[model samples]
Target: MLRMLPFLIVLALWIWAFIDCLTTPEEEVRHLPKVVWVIIILLFGEVLLGPIAWLVAGKQRAVRGPRQTPWAAGDTGNGGYERPRGRQLAPDDDPEFLASLKKDNKQHEDMLKQWEADLRRREEELRGKDDPDAGRRG
Candidate 1:
């Protein structure tokens, strides 16, 4: 069990690093491209070097400071930066966004209906061609 402890620690660190690398946004990834970082983490994670490098440089670590938004300056009452506002609603939750999505979905449905009608017409025309007696019978 003692010998397995080291292996377990390394495995845990490797998993954490790999997950961290994958979840980190491309814009926040530092030093190397997100793809390269993923590769490095996979290739060297077992040796501890990959996880160490990733923790050190893969993602941009947020400094311990207040958040700043475009609307407000970083200044707070106590000489520290002010924290920004809370997160905004997701697109799906926004009424305007949902409306726009509905509009697009409607448009696509109309287009699909039209296409289906055209296909049916074309299929009928082919059937008419195949049966030379169709016109005569009509």
Candidate 2:
């Protein structure tokens, strides 16, 4: 087992480099094309050169800030979930969506009221024709 440690470390580094190269975006690859970097890593992985080269200079790695969770902005009164910055809100959570729904509902109600009025007018005309005395009685 002791004799295998160095080999295992190199193997692990090779595998890590291969995966990192594959997962790196094409636009983010530096100094060489992404495919070339992949091939280099695979070809010289056992010798530690390719993996080291890739890790040191093959990719343009961004210095990322601390990650923010959905609840990082506090409860927001929305089941403890807050919309991430620059992300779209769900329809149910969007004020604009609710406003549009209310506007549609008002339009529908107005249309329904107009239809009911028209129907009542038509019924009154039909009743007058059936019995000319109907309006006189009312």
**TM-score list, all predictions:** 0.49, 0.49
10-127 in candidate 1: lDDT tens per residue?
9999999999999988999998899999899999989999999999978899888886554455456344645535876788777978999999999999999999999999999999
How does residue 32 of candidate 2 score in lDDT?
A: 95
lDDT of each: 0.88, 0.90
RMSDs, each prediction? 9.2, 12.4
Weakest 10 consecutive residues, lDDT, candidate 2? 69-78
What's the distance in Å from true for residue 60, model 2?
1.1
lDDT of model 2 at position 9 = 99
In candidate 1, stretches whose alpha carbon ends up further than 4 angstroms from where it belongs are 66-138
RMSD of 1: 9.2
